[model samples]
Target: MTKLLNVAGAISLLLGFIVSSNAVAVDEQPQSLSQLQSLGNNNQNISNSSLQQGTFNKTNRSGVLLPGEASAQELLPAAEEGLPPPFGANLFAGGYESERSDGLNDDYVVAPGDKVSVWLWGAVNQSEVLTVDNQSNLFITNVGPINVANVKASQLNQVVTERIKQVYKSSVSIYVNLLTATPVSVYITGSVIRPGQYAGVASDSVLYYLKRAGGIDSERGSYRSVKVLRNNEVIKEIDLYDFVLGGYLPRFNFKDGDVILVERQQATILVTGSVRNPFRFELDKDESIGTDLIKIARPYAKVSHVGVVGDRADGPFSIYVPFAEFAQFQLKDGDRVFFNDDIRAQIFDIQVAGSYLGPSYFAVKKDTRLYDLLAHIEVDPNLADFQSVYIQRKSVAQKQKELIDQSLERLERSVFTAPASSDGEASIRLQEGQMILQFTERARKIVPLGKVVIAENGKIANVLLEQGDIVHIPAKSDLVQVGGEVMMPQALVYNENATVEDYIAWAGGYSERANYEQIMVINPNGMVRLNATGALKPGDQILVLPKVDAKIMQNVKDITQIIYQIAVAANAIK
Candidate 1:
């Protein structure tokens, strides 16, 4: 009895396990469309029943999961009912349906030469067809051409009714059919895949004409640069690329006589001057720097200098840069890049001496001009004559011919020449590590005689100076002498190119009492009267004289009048 009970218990446990698995599988199954709708209806019913019982919870009795069991197909109609029509939809859909029926007639008026069609409702023998041509009046009718062509179907029905009323007076209806329709033609040309004249089509819309002309040529055409020409003039540029690629709808519709044209791309960046391959490169992207120019010149180019030449609407600019340092530069479209092969070597030392720059000394590459060394040591302009400047140069065997040629050119141009034996004359080339000494016989004599006017507010006293050297200025004097009067006058030492107006300005200019219109300049050459606009010379004296006042002139005139009256009275007495 114990063995039998154990086997029975195992069988019952297996059966329970199988039933539980089947229950889970049934719960995981997907419901059909009809079943889903039934389930939704049941839920709604349950909520309603709970509400009637007055024991419904807030969460359980809110609403049904799918109200009214709405399907996916019904959702669009439901949404559209709650919204307004899209733009142009109301006008495009059934907007012109009311103006369709205005002409209708059914009647037959027979003439001897007229053809007419007539039909009775149930009598075929009463039907007749007739025609009228080239007569002032119909043979069997009283209707005329003026009355036939201008008459509407309804008006013709009224005329037939009046005629019938004269003969029997019967009511009748009439109908008319047009044998021809209106003609329309449009022409499509320029930048299209196939261009021709099309007929029986709408002439006012570009999209309608484009569809007739095989649309845009995407493989060989640019949709962005399309231009529409109307009556030989550009009306608009249609960006079809934006419409096709960006999903943008066009705003303005087309009109009659429009011509569409597509523009070609423009080439940019003219690379010329010493480049291996010089051509106009087209800019495919946003490029505004000189890097691409360097890349174009990298092959078969030394690139010693890269010159950027640009011309805007305002003006033009030219900038030269070393090729090694041109990486920091930027370029614009239409800019020209000139690649040169001639490279400049760096200078080690430059010389300084005499009227020259200095003794030959090693210097940097780009710092070997004449003005650079002149600023270093204080050189008196009055004592150091710069006009007769010269330079001494040394060259190895390899550079002998070139240096000689350069030297001869410099001498011919007077860049380097011999000195003149005078107070304001000297010459010599400067070498490196050499000192320059400038001296003048007059400077030595005037050093003991005190300061002479080298410049205004600056004095020069030549102490121990030698030949081929420079001198320093110590102090300046303020005294300027004015000999003749014009206005407030003073004295000034004469400069090399001093003029009469400069002296007048130094003496506080012309005063109000002075006659500036007539100024007299006195020099060793003699007195010369001149206007205020006249040029002045060194060692010249200016005379600023005051005009006679009006009061003094009036007093003199009164005295003369009194004397004349006395003389006249005495003569009358005699």
Candidate 2:
């Protein structure tokens, strides 16, 4: 019987500890939910750090991987997971608190507990700073009690002056000023980060208290349904979007015990692409159309068309229409509207660099040919090498990078996954893998020049040019450059009769690590010849590639292939 009682006591203590641990409030009073959440978060962080430390110690003690840890590390994040954060989400980020006014507004009505300064100077010198009593009247020595409560700050001086004139008409100047306004304690509740009572002046804007309470809960709170309540009755409903779109916020003096409530989020639409504000917006009405959104979305570019996608009664539906018809289309909840400048313009701009005169950029038609542009280009015939002119394009560079990445990925997988028969072999494989990884990393940083080999048989190709293409007219040079594994890399005087080997020999020959058999001769137009027998030309460069020596023959072959690919794509020694 005693043992049973002891067990029951132990159980009661355990239950008490659990309940106490979750309690956020010191007593049985309502507390700020945001503060409670912060406290809980701190505890959670402490628990997580402790658990992680223990896990680390255990892992160190036993040299084996744990299932839970491995799975957690391997978890992959989804792409484009959720909608962009709602507009006006960052409105009440405590910046409004600094702008809080200490003075009362012109329209602010004087209430009890407010102080008013009254001075009568000319006829009778008298001054007194009087506080408004419960009867809403200010008592003066000469002019008995005057009802000044519920009076506008702008009209207070007029009212007081008129009352003083009744006593003394001539030589009596009255000066009236509001010394201080009554401080009101406002309750900020419902969908706010910290929902609690905050103290501020009666003339304080709703934003002042809202910011004091840690702003609105952006995800769950509605920017449209923020209500100012007095005695459980809503006096005003504020739509924050009005302030965000046009700098307009309604001026309403807060009273004591007034409540600032941020209601739950309403129906929303996601606006994306080509807009100044690409964010999810809450609808004022359920039946709102695309017209309502354009006012806030404010597409920065000329929106040619819009694509609307949403779940309808007929299942997922999508509509594509011109911007004119977009206003008539009614929107629903969770709809995604994409504004696109889809109409392809007739003219696009292309840049010209190197030996050229006049404007380097030309606005040409979409179907403009290379020869058509070259015809207009003014260049010095002595300086411009028109035969070796080439085109550099963005699309070509992207494609080259993609291909190089694919080859590197394949090489990495093959090298890392190769089986080891013994511990010594495994150690050797680890060192080789690290070296290969470093090489791949460095190779990935290489940006291909994306040179189009348009020059063939001393003639330039008259291919159709695309937007953003750079037309480079090579300047005529009388020097041949040799670099890479060469002992001395420099430019030599032009020798038309010199072969690839002759240039290398003149540049102090190749270093000990040079792959002599895999010599590369690169033309100014980014043409690669992988032999020593090619005819050397002025302004051409010769790169002596470094040889790869590895324990595994396959590793050597893979490394060699990547090195050669980098040379061809970038025309660099790497």
Candidate 3:
């Protein structure tokens, strides 16, 4: 009785406050079909006078809408941020405009305006689609009115069949089915994207109306306590998490003027990374345990550790805990949790390409050396060029790419930022900058092979092998190649007695743009020698670099350095 009095006093106080604020409280009617459609057209427009009354006037405890009271849309991050949309936000993506009323559930209660198809044969032949009247009675042609207002659809067949049997006396065969359910206009209020009246069939699930109302306000709306109010009392309470975590939504029939009040969000925790459902989850209480969060997060198999960060009594705090001990960890309101795959692997796989007869891939320990694996690699002695073996590492490629990008950036900055003393110099610089820009774009597309020189001076270095390394053993080749700024770039028969100049001469000499001083002789194992003039061996490549002439000596130097960087990184000239 004391608690009831306290509630009564609170209600009286709320009414007095509403009157004093000059806010007239009236029964808002459900919108028409056109108005409902217009409401969904723009979610921003739906929060007009009705929404202000529902969200601010009535639900506002302090009689004023605080800045902290934000709608669902306001809570979401900007689309430009590339963040994931809030959980259950996609539920209102539309398609709730029309729902089949014929698919009725067994527990659906009979209501006014609901159509029932009754067919009779045998003694009496009558087929009629009867509508339920206001008094919840379906009037038959000859039989008296049958009360089916509150009767379940499942029991309607039994009730109507028994009544017809009484009238026809075992001669009439009756078949009754709930043809169409009554359409209802439900008032959706509280923390939702659009707080307005939405029209849907009585048989339609609660999600239909919620979807039509633009789903729950992800930021402010409480998915844990969605109430369906009839008259002034709550008839059903829906927990959307039950539907999200476990595919379960409570069954309920909505009536006209029914209010679905989504209470403001309670305590929440933001979960991200290495979890199946990485979204902000609302808690039933201010404080919960890791076990409660585990049920919602559903971390992936690779996730072994959890990092939690939030405020504490002392100050802001953070802790990294193993997945096993997370169950016992205490979680607070507004905490941020991140699951991580922190455990290092004991063994990693590496691929071996070219000339080896054994398995293409091998899973080896972290301390496995290149020489240890090389000893086990079965190769044809006549075909395999073991002396030209090298390792291609992904990490090396990434580092080489970074260095090339940094050099290109520096080259671009130098070309564009060079001080021009006169208009003629500026014009020349502008034209040169454009040409350099084109060259830089072409250079940027080159992917470095990341060749690690394991063999030098005919000796293989037994270095530790890294993850994702490709150990390549070249095939025996008796061909010498000549390319880059040469008149005719082609592969020719290997001449062991020929020098670097002889290979360039055999390829029809250098072009007009070729830099005579910048000739490079590349070995089969990716070792580059500048202006090498000794006797060239088989599988050797002679590349003639292009000349770079700039008015500024620094520009010429930078371009030459970039050329060398590209030649070493990609083994090609730009």
What is residue 183's positional error in candidate 3, in angstroms?
1.8
lDDT, model 1 = 0.37
Q: Candidate 2, which segments miss by more than 4 Å at Cα?
A: 1-80, 98-107, 119-125, 168-174, 231-233, 300-302, 313-315, 550-554
* Model 2 weakest lDDT span, ten residues long: 16-25
Q: TM-score rank, highest first?
A: 3, 2, 1
Query: Residue 276: error of model 3 in Å?
Result: 2.8
Residues 60-158, model 2: lDDT tens digits: 112123444222112111114666888987777557776657657898889888889998888699988999898988888877888986788999999
Error of 1 at 185 (Å): 24
Q: In terms of TM-score, how similar is model 2 to the real structure? A: 0.80
lDDT of 1 by residue, 375-445 (tens): 33333344433322222222211133333234333433342243446543332122100111111111111
For candidate 1, the per-residue lDDT at 89 reads 17
Clashes of each: 55, 0, 0
Question: TM-score of model 1 relative to the true fold?
Answer: 0.17
